[model samples]
Target chain A: MLPDATLADYALRLGDDSLVLGQRLSEWCGHAPMLEIDLALSNIALDLIGQASHFLKFAGRAEGRGRDADSFAFRRDALDFRNCLLVEQPNGDFAQTMARQFLFSNWQELLFAQLQHSANDTLADIARKAVKEVAYHAHFANEWMVRLGDGTEESRARTIAGLEWMWRFTGELFERDPALKPLVDAGVAVDVPSLRPDWEDRISRTLAEARLELPKPRRWVMGGRVGHHSEHLGHLLSEMQFLQRAYPGAMW
Target chain B: MNAELPLKDRVLEILSQVADPEIPCVSVVDLGIVRDVRDGKVFITPTYTGCPATAVIEAAIGKALKDAGFALKVATMLSPPWTTDWISDSGREKLRAYGIAPPDRGTAKHSLRDVPVECPRCGSRHTEEISRFGSTPCKSLHRCLDCREPFDRFKCH
Candidate 1:
C-alpha cells in the first residue's frame, strides 16, 4: 500500500496548485480589463476550486485521516504544502501574472493529459475534467502571451521581463520525488521526469509564437515536492488561512 | 451514425440541434459538452464560466429530449470544467461559417483577439472590440470598421 504520508504529500501538491492559482486569479475578479475577461477569470477560479476540493478529499481518504476537504485545505501548515514554487509567487503585475500563467498552464496542459489516462480511476476522472479546463486556460494564456509578445514594444518588453522573473521556478514542476515512485509504478501518478520534454516544447513554442525568447535556463530552484517552499508561500497562507483560523468553523 | 445506434445515438442526434444560445450556430450535443447520458437523464456542463444562458441550455436540452420521446433528468457537473477544445470540429466550422471566430483550447499562451473579427454583416475582417461584454455574458461587442456594422464576437472564455 502506498504510505499515508505519501498520499497526503501528493494530495497537498495537487491541492496547492489549485488553491494557489485560484487565489491569484481571484485577484482579477472585479478588476479584469473587460467584463468578459472578468467572467473568464471567475470561471477558471471556479474550476480550480473544484480541483482543489477533489485532491484534498482524496488526500483525506488516502491519509486515513478523518479530515475532510475543508480540513485538508484549511488545517494544513505552511510547511506541509506541496504545490509548485511557481504558484506561490505573488501576482506582481498583470504582465508578470500572465507570464506565470503562460508557463504553468503550459505545463498543466501536459500534466493533466497524462493524468487523464492514469490507471487510477479517481485521478483519471479528475484529470479528464481538469484537462478540459486547462486546455482553455492554456488557450487563455497563449492568447495573452501572443498579445504581449506581439503587441506594442513596451508590452513585449514587459512580457519578456515577466517571463525571466518566473523562468527559474519552472524547473520545480518536473522535479520528481521518491514518494511518487510507488504511485508512478502503479500508474496512479505521472513521472515528473516524463513531462519534461513536452513541457519544454510547448512553452518554447508559445514563447516563440509570442515573439519572446526564453532566457537560457540557469540553475533552477527546487524543493516544493518535498514540502519545502519559497518565502512567498508562508505569507500567502497567512492571508488565506487567516479568516478560517480567526473564526474557527465559520460558514458563509 | 444514426441507423446503427440505439437510444443514446438518437438522443445525441436530436440534442445536437439544440444550438448554443450565444453562438446559435452549433447545437450543444455537437459541441461535445454533453459528457454523459444514462436512463433518459442528461448531463451537461457549461462551455463558459458564469454563463447566463445555462437556463436556456437546460431548457433546450429538456425540450429536445422530450421531443425525442425521452423523459428528462438533467444534471450539470461543474467540476473538471468545460473547454472550447471540447467544441466539436463541425461545431467550430459552423461557428466560423456563422462569422464568429472560434476559441482555441486553453493550451494557448496568449489570449489575443488577434484576427480582425469578421463583420457578421459583410464578412470583412476589420473588426475591433467596442466592449468585452455584449448582448449576453459570453460575448464581446465588436464593430467592423469596414462595414460600419457592429456584431458580437464570442469572447475567448
Candidate 2:
C-alpha cells in the first residue's frame, strides 16, 4: 500500500471536487427557475457537501495533522484546491448547471462504484455511501438533460450550448497523475484512465437520448488538479470561506 | 424485560422509543438505523447520507440516550450502508397508516419506475410522481388518482 501522505492527497482531490461543486450548486438556492428544480439542486448539493466532509475528514486523519475537514475546507486558498476544472466552472444557466452535473456525476458514479471496494477501508466505506447518492444525482441530471434538450426551440439550443461549453473540461477527469500512480497500483485509489471509456459511452447515450449532438472534440482544458483554476473559483472561495476565515472557530 | 440485563439492552429499549424526526410515525430503531449498543457506545448507520434528517436522527438518538441516564457515544458507520430493506415491517405499516407510501421491496435504484407505488390513502395502484424530489431528499412527491391526495413516498435506495 502507498504511504498515508499520498492517500491523504488523493482524498483531498476527491473532497475538493465535491466541495467546490457543492458550493456552486448551493448558489442556485432561491434562484432556480422552478421550486421543484430548486429543491432538487439544493438536495444534490447537500449530498455532495456531506460526501466532501467524509473524504476531507479521512484526508485529515491520513495526513496525521492536527487540522480537520473544516480547516482544510475553510482555510485553504484557491491555489491549494485540487478539484477538476469542471466543478469550479460557473453555473452559467439552468441548462449549463444540469450539463455540468450530468458530466461530473456520471463520472463520479463510476469512480465511486470502483472505490467502494478499495483496499483502504475508510475510503471504501465513503465510496459505498457516495455511489448511492451520486446514482440519484446522475439520474436527476440526466432527466433534466433530456427535458431541456427536447423541451422547446430555445431550451434545446441552450442545452446544446451548455454541453459544448462543458465538454472541454471532461478530459481532465481521466488524466492519470503520476502522484496517484502508486496508490492506484496498491488498489487504494481508482485508476482514472480505466473510467474514460465507460464515461464516454454513458455520455454518448445520454446526449443521443436528449437529441443533442455531441460537441466535436477540441483542445482539452487542464490544470485544476494542480490548483490552477478559472477566475470564478477565486470569487466563489471568497464568499464560501468568508465566515470561517473571518471568525476562526465560530460555531452555531 | 429483566432488570438484571445489561445497560446496553436498556439503552436499545430506550432508543426504540425515539421517533425519527422527519417521519414521526416510526422510531429510529424501527427505521433500522440503530445498529447496536455495546460498551457505552450506541452505533447507528444513518439512512441517507445526504438526507437532512440523518443529523436530526443522530441528535435525537444522542438526547434519548443521555436522557435515559446513559453516557453512551453515538457512533456512525458508513459502510455496510443502511438500505430501505432494513426498515422493519412495523415501520412499513406505520408509514402506510401515516399516509406516506413505504418503499417497495427490492426496487432497483436506477429504475425508479420499475415498481408501482400504491396510494397509502386509497390502496390504488393509480399513483403518479409529481416530482422526483419531495419535502426531503429521501422522498418523492406523488399524487393518488383514486383519492386525489398528494403524499410523499420514501425513495427506495
- Identify the candidate with maximal lDDT: 2
lDDT of 2 at A43: 87
* Residue A244, candidate 1: alpha-carbon lDDT: 84
Give the distance in Å from residue B70's predicted Cα in candidate 1 to where it truly belongs.
18
CAPRI tier for the interface of model 1: incorrect
* Chain B TM-score, all predictions listed: 0.74, 0.89
Model 2 Cα lDDT, one tens digit per residue, B37-71: 77668889977666678888889988987887788
Clashing pairs in 2: none
Error of 2 at A228 (Å): 0.9
True contacts kept of each: 0.13, 0.70
Model 1 spans with C-alpha error above 4 angstroms: A1-5, A33-37, B1-157
Model 2 chain B — which ten-residue stretch has the worst lDDT? B106-115
> What C-alpha lDDT do the candidate models reach, one value each?
0.76, 0.88
RMSD of 1: 6.6
TM-score of 1: 0.69
Q: On a 0 to 100 scale, what is the lDDT of residue A37 in model 1?
A: 72
Question: Candidate 2 vs. truth: CA RMSD?
Answer: 1.7
lDDT of 1 by residue, A1-252 (tens): 343777566776887798888877887888987776776677677667777877887788878757788886777787878888888888887788889988898888799889888887766777776775677677778888998899999899888888898999988888777867988898888887889888788888888888888778798988876678889888877877888899989996
